[model samples]
Target: MFFTDSRLHFFRPLVGKYREVVVECVRLLYQKLYTDLTGYGQSHGRDFVIDVFVEAIARAPLLDEEVGAPEGRFKDARALAGFILNNLLDNGWMERRLDEATLQSHYGFTRMGRGFAQPFVESGKLEYRSRNRNTRNTRNSLQAFAEKGEVYDLLDALEYSERIISDFADTIAELEERRLQLVREVESRQLIEQAADQFFDFIDTVFKPDLEVRLSADSVEKYRDQIASLIRQVRRRRKYGEGEHAELLWQTVMEMRLRKLLPGRVVEGQSLLENIVHTIEERLQSACDIMLPALRRALNSFTARADIIIRQLSYLHRQADEPLLDACSRLREMSPDNQEQALQRMGQVLAGVRSGWPASEQFVLRSRNRRRTVRATLANAPGLDRDAQKAQFISQVLDQAFHVSSQHIRAYVSDKLITQGRVYSKHLAVQDARQLLALAHVVSLAGERLDNGFEILIHPARSDSAGLQVFEASNCGDGYFDSRENFELELVDRQRAS
Candidate 1:
């Protein structure tokens, strides 16, 4: 067991393997979290791991308070690191990721970041990488790259959480102040209404039209119902000496009564309610005429602007680029209908993108399993085109953009199109997997001009110089998922000698 010496900035004489186990757990959880987040219908999430981290220790009833919050959450590199250290101070290795079976439990290492739902989720298949098709490589890649991404960001976020909270606090404080002002304005408006006409304007209207008069019981019943509705509104607003608001509302009601009374023409054959209905109709019409255009323009203007960013991000998602979600901040007055429309639009576009296009001579299969081929039976069909690829390679671009190597520039077909009798084999070291995961970030960057499909050949080109060569996507008419930092496909082994 160990206690933290806050001054020294290290755990004081911690027991053996405790720190290592803690670090490994943190790393595993973070990696798994992101993978699962991108993965659809996942049982595990960052939230689950965070919940475990909090509950494993006794920080019960986690509060969303700012300031005087855990300072340790700020300085530690890994989110769970401080919590683990604190646990060491309190208890020993009780239970967590200290065993094999527990590690392989639910929310285990199997989940891959997948709903993503635009291009990836629509087609429930992994990217068209050459190696992933071979069961061995697929298993190896998932096992290897599962926990690396957490090392990059989750730890960073945890270590700097306090700073993030502090920044967020300032923003919330501003909103709170604005909210107070709005409350006061509403209170004042209520006071003015009580003195002027009625405290609640909506319920104050006590009269409505009663035209199409008749003598039968059904017609009489309708008129009676209208009379009850009108009386209910009048009574609801008629609070006795409540406040300044009530006084103002009372005065306004009296004035309205005076206007309808007209010098004691109480003996008139026409009802007082008929005149009141005419007044209410005129006012409601005036408000609608003035407000309708402005409301529509505001809604349309915001949707039009937001639709641009949303559409672009949706397309980029197909290309497997990191979606810029903050783009939605530009959207104002976003209704449920708008959201459904945009999401459906993305699905439609993805549907049109027939998989394994340039590589497959003709679309075939009642149910295509692999990410290869979709033969549509149409007499007049459009030419297989990839003008977008040419546009991407148009101008001299960034390093990632220019870095297609040369199998990358060439055999750009789906992996299922690999030669008929060729077999894939790999003895990929764990270290090589780590290196590839790191390089995934470099390869999937924004300016990358990879032609949607490519191959990475990892072989010993010389006696000492075993290296990697990327074949560009020359045959791929179009594709996405080049931005995958956590995954990659490489021709790990190849030999024809029997």
Candidate 2:
């Protein structure tokens, strides 16, 4: 009961906060429900609705027309407008109020309707005609970090991203200094503990966030290059027209004017451009100069050092065991005979004898189920014999070479030269191709004359008649055969026997 009471009291404030959030969310959902009553189906014009809501006046003349006689089944414009207002009121999207002074009725958005529409107005989504305003806002923020002066003045935006890089370098430098201090001198336990906490905080807040944005020395160098390039563009403002990049540079110039840094537009000061360029390069150099190799070493060893310190601290609290002390005393007092008897027993247990069981012809189970295995050849049944496939492949290669009398060995050996049946290309992979060539080479060495009227000959792959022409296979990914090596295949003309 006490635990339940404590838990209930602790969560009372959180429950109250959650209830308020739920009410706000429900109000938002009702406002953005996109009812047919808004007289705006999915195809309704967003701009017209926004203008009507913001300016409190309808753009279309038909919407402002007063009630008149019904034409066919159609009601008058004023009557139709009243029907829509009544629908919105019923849906909790709008409310009708009576003015005490004038004693007149007026309509406006309810709490739900105002809250829901506030986000679109504030985010500039309503101002932009396109529905992809969210994506555009995100892109603009990213571009502000990249190209010159997108979010702020040209000089100031460069300084902002540069400062993130500088802060990252400074954090690494501080970590290095602490590491050196701990290494060189015996620091107090309290100091070491504080340093450890700071190390964890650095990784969480500064280190991780910087890495997320890639605010490193290498990134700083890239930013420096971009800044320098922008400065050059500003210096040569006369040559370039208002192209895409030139327009962006002009925007930065405009931002500078707004900040009162530039006078009378047209950024023509070459000296000022050079000064800005120099300052960016100086900041980049300072960031890159910081060498924090100890950061990695410290991270790896920090845990191990803490573990060692914990063990040392715990040593003071470790209690001695009386039973273990008694066992040591007993071991010291043991006689030689008793020690020999104990050693004999231990040796007998460790050097265990091999126990042999009688060999049985069969094993009989108490109850066994009569298994009915429905044996059938599956789709993954064993493939056709590989030797027949290899021999057929070799035959096909030789058949293609039969047309050319005394064919050059290298001609038939290559995957490119084998045209008939396309054994190398269509049917077989590289390993199979190599096997086919090698088999053909062996058949040729036997000096066999086939029915195709050509005698197979194998020779060393050399320029001379005595040496054979070597055919090396392409590199096989499966590594089934030796890729490097050669043997020539030549189709020699057979002599006519009378």
Candidate 3:
């Protein structure tokens, strides 16, 4: 179908033996005639186009046989340029028109010709970084649709999502192509400099500017949740909202003829809005689930191959310069018997080498002295005092006898609450020092996993005498449990727990 078009006949010149001349001519024509701020500025007259073609043909290198032989049929740049220009005009690559005011013919490229020539012109220039903003544009478009509730905004989001997918796919393919090209170069030429240059060129032009940005700030995962939320909100409102919203959505769909954009026949009952939303959702899902992983793998594979090549090159480069490394490489390449012989020879060459303290130098050594021991007799031991022994017994009893724990506190509270449904801190009966200690620990243990079937509520105690009940207890002296806060213990109903 593509070859059936008559306009594509211009491709013949590009594939012919004199393609170099034709390519150069097209590049010059684009640069001179169309590279203007206001795209393809006013067309130039026939003489000007001829001059551009002549310059390109003169600069281009052609085979001596093609230029000087009988079949060439051209002897000078002017004649060759004229023939090429006529071929282009007749083949639909260039157009000629007469201006009424000037009464002369003007020349310019046709639309298809200009489109095809764009890549050639760009490839000749240096591209430092990618200028794509599809990821950011997709996010902004969806956000706009969410805020404005406009059908056009949703359409823009869908378009941007598709563009991002295409861009990622192109990036992956280009990376793989570059990797294969680099591998071929390394295999054919085995030149480290050229390979390193191309590798860094890729990093500067592609990896850092495009892939790195996509993996970080421009990543789909970064904006996936927000985009998904907005998409759902828009779909819900457009699909199920009241009459006014639905009418407006349908009007937009009809006006834009969005139904025609669907790939296949619409289902029996599906609506335009649903189809668009589904398509957009599918594109985003493919990007996240398929494209991202493929991109990561492609990048990792390229880098790993480049790394291995560069490391191998570097090692070879070192082997060529360093004697020791060269020897090791030679030894590795030799047979087992030869390798053993070489190593033995190397050992014999270095067998007498020794550098440390000289044998003539001597130093004296000192001996260590033994430690003295002393023994005590039973007759010299002093008798134990009864007072000290009694004081020690009291100290041990005070330290170990009155230690209270959470179980003890729980038991005390349970005993107090046994007579009633609840009890307050003021009513707690402290019978001895142990009960006083247990009461002190109840507040600390309240927040822990006591597993006690009760809850503690702490509140400020009232200043009235009835609220400030006192408890009498004794350790080795008189003591009272006083506090400004009161705690209430209520039984946890086991019926609800069950």
| Candidate 2 segments exceeding 4 Å error | 1-152, 173-270, 291-498
Candidate 2 residue-wise lDDT, 146-243, digit = tens: 44444344456445536644445554565566456544332564454455565556457644554324434334444545554544554553422355
Model 2 misses residue 173 by how many Å? 5.4
Regions more than 4 Å wrong, model 3: 1-10, 36-43, 58-73, 129-132, 149-151, 188-190, 238-270, 324-498
**Each candidate's lDDT (Cα)?**
0.35, 0.45, 0.74
Q: Rank the candidates by TM-score, best first.
A: 3, 2, 1
- In model 2, how large is the Cα lDDT of residue 177? 64
- Give per-model TM-scores: 0.14, 0.25, 0.57
Candidate 3 vs. true structure, TM-score:
0.57
Q: Write the residue-wise lDDT of candidate 1 on 178-243 in tens digits.
A: 334434543453332232222122113311111111112213222333433433343343433544
The numbered model that scores best in lDDT is 3
Q: After superposition, how far is residue 62 of candidate 3 from its true place, in Å?
A: 3.7
lDDT of 3 by residue, 56-163 (tens): 988888854444332356788788888888888877788888889979888888888899888878877774545357767877887886665566776887898898
Evaluation by TM-score, superior candidate among 1 and 2: 2
